[model samples]
Target: MKAKPCENILGLAMGSEQSRLRQQLVAASMGMVTTHVLGVCVQLKICDLLRDEPLAISELARVTGTQPEPLRELLIILASLDVVTIEEEAVALKPSGRLLLADQTGNVVQWVQYAAEFCAPAWMELADVLLGIPPAAGSKRRIYDALSSKRYPAEIFHGAMQDTQVEISATLAEAIRLNPGEVVADLGAGQSSFLIELLMRYPNTSAIAFDRFSDFTAMKQLAHAQGVAGRLQTIRGSFLDPLPFRVDVIVFKNVLADWSMEHLKRILTMARQGLNPDGRMYIATTFVHDPPSPDEAVVSLNLRVLTEGGDRSEVDYVAIAKEAGFELTRQERVAAIMILEFSLKGTA
Candidate 1:
């Protein structure tokens, strides 16, 4: 019996769908492998070495301290990925590969390294995390705790945060309107990149970087390098404790999402006490959309949840701020982050 035309068409459509599904699965699996491969490239400074010119496979292996055969295999993989070009037994960095260099303007080497080394392992335990089991590092320890305790590489983590914040900080500096000579305090400011950007833009303003375990020496060096050292100060203490002094503006960039709602409220309440009578607070964080679009924000929320802290929607943020004795005054979305401005309830 021969199939009818309609039945044959349906069979073809089904076959196409199955093929598409298979392709999707393979792509996802390969994505996981590619992440670690990129991490290894960054760790070995392969792109940096290839920046000026191509290198013979043996020479590359000698410099990188890897066996030539394995190095060639890796280079072949990178060539296939379009991150490098290989010909005549030599490998050269591609334009895309240049973006992995440490000194590049928009480099993502640290972010890729941090994601592969720290976040990827946590993601592997996502199924168990959904089932209420914490990440394997320890159930009781949060990511920040691990950073403070030296379990994770603090410099790389902070550098990754700086990489992620560069554009957002520029956007925020333009979005914010700071008065001349106003004092700004950034709680949990890792390397004070945002504050440095703000200080550079608003020359008359001064800023404070407050955190319990930041590399203050590096922060000062960065500030000095940026020529903002005269206007920026460092305060070493936990934000959970009372702020050492009052300021006109309090900024929370990528901080609150790491904590639970109760802690968020408590932190806001403490922050409120440290604000001047007419002070304003700004929180820059990734907010979960109401309908939850499958984008970077959602991906960030998933990673946050896997580590036992997750993002919330704008409605939830408003409610939480109200509970903390503050009211939302304005909100703006910059890339995947939201900069929410708030003031004490009933303030003029």
Candidate 2:
């Protein structure tokens, strides 16, 4: 058999299909590596070791009180992912991993655990989620609703919310430009991640953080623990109702993805009405590729959307804003969340 030679760019691309396939395999393999490293880091507390000095595996075992042999293997594997390194006589977190997989008093270690606890089991049902009506994970029904009970989801949901909020709040601080002089309203602000972080960053600003009445007690304690107690005001109400106060900025952090586009727009419309003319609106949440298309998160989010039915793209959201008389200023990615900014036309 004779091999065909490339004549033009398209011809070259056609010959490179194998490379594309290899690229996909590499991408998928990276995800598997990430999942594996997460599990071991939690057990070995590799981040804890890196917290002090670059400890050797033996010392890590001593500090954490685990066997060195297993920890050595774990560190070696972690080294491959650059989550940790086994250098000369010490193990340490790589710079990139340090930002995420670490606990320096502020840790989202639970999200890694969430990945393992909720997602790993769901992946097992991927075959079903992809083909069947819908898997338990993708339904808009909360874990409690799908499981036909409320106890389990409530117990773990807040922890997951807090864990997810920690990482999200960090990135949002950078992505969202705010004025310390301006008052801010946090809608659906579970645990008030924004209020806690802002109190430390902006001395002049005060926040009116709102969430479900059910979440008030715990969120109150969290606000105090973050040391923003004086500046933090918890407003108890559902987002569907009128905000009791007016503010310069309103943030819907990680709230939109749970809804259908129509419902989402309705909520944004309601939010727009509550804002001062010069007020700014900020929404942050993550989304998967067109959800009807095949995706890992489809099972979980699909059900969630069905319940509220509002996860949408920038275009869809912008269209909604236009309909509601607000202008879409910009959309950008921050970590896994999409940050959307809006303003009332003719206002700041």
Candidate 3:
């Protein structure tokens, strides 16, 4: 499993136009190699090793428990991907590589690891699965089953969810209105990172972070570290189960895009049933276009391989919400993710 790099045109001017074009094509075709190289570097904490100073290939290989020859080749590939800089047989971190550091607030290394090790493997079987030659062998199924079994990939999945929460927390906190003292529930909350962030930002707010998994050790520690443990409660149960308490806001962020239409409606109905008189429901997802662009194509394929369904337009979302006894009040786009707000039908 490896990431497929997007086409980069900046390096195309190094040779004649025809030759450059050919080079670009070759680079694009081998993008998976670039992704794996970067993933390996992060998994090995190579950037952390080189954070203070450049390291010779031999030293890096010794520290990472690898042979120098192959490690050097991987570092060279990373250099091409602008992840690291190679100088006279030594390597140092690049700015882009800094984002992969595990200590950084916006670190993407976990997401990259999940993409390369989990999602990419599923994607490799996309053509056969689409053609119905074999069953869906996506990591989604593996990860889903791993949760109950408490397996290793489940932790990787948690790390990936944290990465996504780190990327979208600020936008999500601002996009939806959260009044002080309001009770907010995040359905299918992974790691409860977003709820913890909101609790920090809105002191008077109390939140319920609900998910299916039995483990909440890391989430409780996170809330305690953020000094909001008293206000945030973790609930372990399936989203399909009936909710017992009513809340001011119910969020299904990044949750619906993976669900089948029937399950989506069921979840929406649960939200509706759990809402207070004037409560609001927020559904966030990345929608696909009718004529899917390259970016949308990747997203759609990712969803298809990982979940029961893929992305749908806002119109489709609205129609589905209506069936669940909710009315779409507004929709806003924050970067690439869409945040749609819904209210109980016939309510102000």
Candidate 4:
């Protein structure tokens, strides 16, 4: 996904009415003012408090331990966000919001919780990044850092990534087809969702989930959750360092985008050396860009340069893989995602 060229608006200095409107938009977007908003489940909880269905503001505030006035204001914004419906000023969670509140398939509560605490704070520094500040420097003052050390940040990051990967795991697992004893490793595999899904599909196969020392606890948690603890070996180290073994398959998911082309090449080079005689690799990226991040530019891509070491991109990743001595095997598209597979030059 190549980036579209941004059209610069010239002459906003002139008193053109269009310039004034654009200025207003820019101000609102930059947090000169904010529209208070709540997540889906948070709004649903308010709905539940209101009545058996939709409740009036007073009833909602009484039930949810929030002031009625604030609850009403929140509802107005939520209604506009489409999380709820207002009937004669009585607000209730919409169907989508109900799904968000569902515990099993939704998992939105975790997402919202993570956003409120984990991801939101660092985003506040995006402007700093744009002004040529690096994420490591931003991390120093990050609220997440204040809440926990490097270890906790890594844990929260892995958890958040896992939450994100949950949306694609089933489809990705379906796209993958590997044989028994065909070594597969999830390099930089944080919480092991990909490896776990692979193991479930190929119960007889063995695999490894590898990442930095920070990911050790997450790997353990994922291993326990997937019930693949015994078959799954956990490798705790940096991907830039030597890997323990070469495998038939290496998955680098949503990883390459955060990486500069050089860091990515190093990773591919290491994995190349680690690959078994017939090893293959896969890489994934999200072309989507999200605006309104707390303080960050390029929300999806900044994850790498900030925490790990890479920036985001919509460049042709196939070229990147090819340069690393890998050739195309398959391309899988699911929803807004694209998963590209590559095999070493000589491998099928």
User: Which candidate number would show the highest TM-score if scored against the true structure?
Assistant: 1
Global lDDT of each model?
0.78, 0.65, 0.78, 0.63
TM-scores, all models, native as reference: 0.86, 0.57, 0.82, 0.65
The better candidate by TM-score, 1 or 2, is: 1
Task: State the lDDT of candidate 1 residue by residue for 107-222, as single tens digits.
Answer: 88878888787777667666675587555556322567677687788778787777656666777777788999899999988874778878988899999999877776667887
Relative to the unseen true structure, what is the Cα RMSD of model 4?
7.6
Better of 1 and 2 by lDDT: 1
Score candidate 2 by lDDT.
0.65
Residue runs of model 3 more than 4 Å from their true location after superposition = 1-24, 132-142, 150-152, 165-168, 178-181, 200-202, 214-222, 287-292, 333-337
Worst 10 residues of 1 by lDDT: 2-11
Model 3: lDDT equals: 0.78
If both were scored by lDDT, which would come out higher, candidate 3 or candidate 4?
Answer: 3
lDDT of 4 by residue, 1-348 (tens): 321111222335637888777865665464411122444335446534532477777766676778777667667656655667778867776765554453436445545545645555555676765576655633732433443445334655565677767656666677778887776788777774777778878987888888763446756666688798788888777677778887888887776655557877777878778887677777765545444344434454346324544434434577766777878888877775677788888877
User: TM-score for model 3?
Assistant: 0.82
| TM-score of candidate 4 relative to the true fold | 0.65
Candidate 1: C-alpha lDDT: 0.78
Candidate 4 has its poorest 10 consecutive residues by lDDT at: 2-11
lDDT, residue 270, model 4: 84
Query: TM-score rank, highest first?
Result: 1, 3, 4, 2
Candidate 2, 1-348: lDDT as tens digits: 322111121333434778656655555554645575676677556686686568777778887888988768667666766666677858877765564544344555656665655555545554553454453554433343543444334423555577657666776666766676778888877664667777678878888878653355666677778777888787767676666778888887766666657777677877888888888887776655655455535544544433434356667777877787788787888656677888997764
- Model 4 gets an lDDT of 0.63
